[model samples]
Target: MFNGEISASSLQQISPVSFAYIGDAVYELYIRTNFLLPSKKISDYHHKVVEKVRAESQASYLQNLYPLLTEIELNWVRRGRNSVNKSPRRLPLQTYQQATGLETLLGYLYICDRPRLEYLLSQIKIY
Candidate 1:
């Protein structure tokens, strides 16, 4: 959905929060697409995302991704991590923020370049 409209350089104009918003959708879609079981219940699908999208969980994903991310991606993650966003309910503040940062990086890579995004996705060790 993000391949043709905006270039990666121009995406810099987008706020980190905005990136996270889109990133949330992108990652959710990816998770859904990756686990395409026709018999799965909606609750089961949501639980899967809940397991992965939580602050601590996403932070772990970011931790694992550190070695694979490029300098630019790392910069984006730092910026997203440092962004002044709201605290998510029931989650630790820093962890939620870090998750947002991870989401932002995911979103940025997604819109900036799909092939690069796919490459990054390939490196993720999903369970």
Candidate 2:
């Protein structure tokens, strides 16, 4: 829902973790919107969304995005990757870092370049 209301410089000052916090919501919303089932199987939809939204899945998405990202986007990824100090014990640190990087990039684009974010999200190969 965020558009050009905020200036680029102001967006730059937001922390990667803050961006990721919002990005996690935004991405989950997107997945829920696009992947919802017409049937009454709520659990099925939940499982599918969980599969796609997990840290490992996000890390895979980030890996696929690397070749397509602009330098500015890559810089945001690096910022997010470097910002992680710890992760849950169940997940490898690198996977969490990469997932955070994806979230950061998504959040940045959502605020500063909505069309770009939509394009990237559409490019994702979702079942």
Candidate 3:
């Protein structure tokens, strides 16, 4: 398994689904970290984390973040958004697409550049 940095070109060649897979994990962890507090109940924390992890929530986030993304970042988002895939019945297709796009972009940054990923997450209000 790749436990190290991957080249940008190589990363780009990987399937968008693969990117979204890892991106999903990374983003969930990011949200969880911010919500961690001893004072908060486990159930409360779980709910808060779930709120951000939903596809609709991610889609909304992606929409608001367009102006903040760089051209390259936006390109990755577009690549993910355009990927053809079926969505879970609970969420709308557009929301799934946008969420996958955001996740793929996050995974791309997480692999290729940690600083950039941190910078992008920093731009958002994770709470």
Candidate 4:
């Protein structure tokens, strides 16, 4: 979890760029944890799951899954997606970054001992 508190004033002072930085790692960890299921072969599973966890796939997942998120979670996703100063990659457009942010925020929440992450994952009808 991010212990660094962002006050209202400080929120304005901070940059989306910075959030994205944290968000990227957070998202990847979530994917790695979630996709590393016991049922799948390691190499084949990694190949299959990596596509879903990547920037483009995550963006698509976010779009399809957005309606299920609660208000607070949605806000976090939006903040991450809308953030500026993102590093460009060979993936799709801006949506990938946003997806990364959402994943990262979810990862952060999970690590912070938030029960909502599990709840949210459960509500996601689409795998």
Candidate 5:
């Protein structure tokens, strides 16, 4: 079995915002790659995908879906949510920051080779 451990030292080295940055791309790529068809117009597909992948949308998703998360997952989300340093933004502060943390956790899990990403995606009752 693969020892799916993320080192504390490695986690400490990465900024929460940086994790969110990579995560936003990773999550969107997952959504776009999964939902967009080869036959569809690229522009139209991208527009449709962006609606779901934006920070606000993701934040809403996380809030509604928070109850479904495991204890460990909740901790990860909290770490990202409570991270002190942040980028400047025009969006609502709380939602945007929470969403950033959500994305960061998702990105972390993706890199950690954890099955939680797929599991959480599968459990999502919303589209």
Candidate 6:
């Protein structure tokens, strides 16, 4: 677990892909914790988690957050989007890029600004 101890300069040195890597895990834990009930079957939990974490779902979440992002936040997203060089075969390139952008931004906030990350995650429509 990151303690948010990294300096701003150091944070900048971290690659967008690296951010996306952490973001993917962070977002998954968040969704599983906040959105799912433990009473549900294990299979049900897996399906719901999968639905929320998919590229298409992530892209939509990014679109919803666009109007609310600050210039700095948008910059992080652009860095993530532009950093994408490859994507899974089943997904469209644009959708995968957008999803990566969202993940990158989430990862950035997770590392550099927990308050903002919580705010953005709260805004996500998971239902």
Instruction: State model 6's lDDT.
Output: 0.92
> Across residues 56-79, which tens digit of lDDT does each residue of candidate 1 receive?
888888888899888999998988
Cα misplacement distance, residue 39 of candidate 5 (Å): 3.1
**Deviation from native of the Cα of residue 106 in model 2, angstroms:** 0.5
Q: For model 6, which pairs clash? A: none
Query: What ranges in model 2 sit over 4 Å off?
Result: 1-3, 37-40
How displaced is residue 111 in candidate 4, in Å? 4.8
RMSD of each: 2.1, 1.4, 1.8, 4.1, 3.3, 1.2
| Candidate 6 accuracy as TM-score | 0.95
Better of 2 and 4 by lDDT: 2
Most lDDT-accurate candidate? 6
TM-score of each: 0.85, 0.92, 0.89, 0.61, 0.78, 0.95
Tell me the tens digit of each residue's lDDT in model 6 across 9-127.
89778999999999898899998997566478888888999999999999999999999999999998999999987889999989999999999999999988999999999999999
* Candidate 6 lDDT for residue 47: 91
The Cα RMSD of model 5 versus the native structure comes to: 3.3
- Candidate 3 residues lying further than 4 Å off, grouped into runs, are 1-4
- Candidate 3, 1-127: lDDT as tens digits: 5566777688658987788898999999999998886669889999999999999888888888899898989998998988847899997888899999999999888877789899888877765
Give the total clashing residue pairs for model 3: 0
TM-score of 1: 0.85
Q: Each candidate: what lDDT?
A: 0.81, 0.88, 0.87, 0.61, 0.73, 0.92
**Which window of 10 residues has the lowest lDDT sum in candidate 1?**
1-10
Kindly report which residue stretches of model 1 are placed more than 4 angstroms away from their true locations once superposed: 1-9
Off by over 4 Å in 4: 1-40, 111-113, 125-127
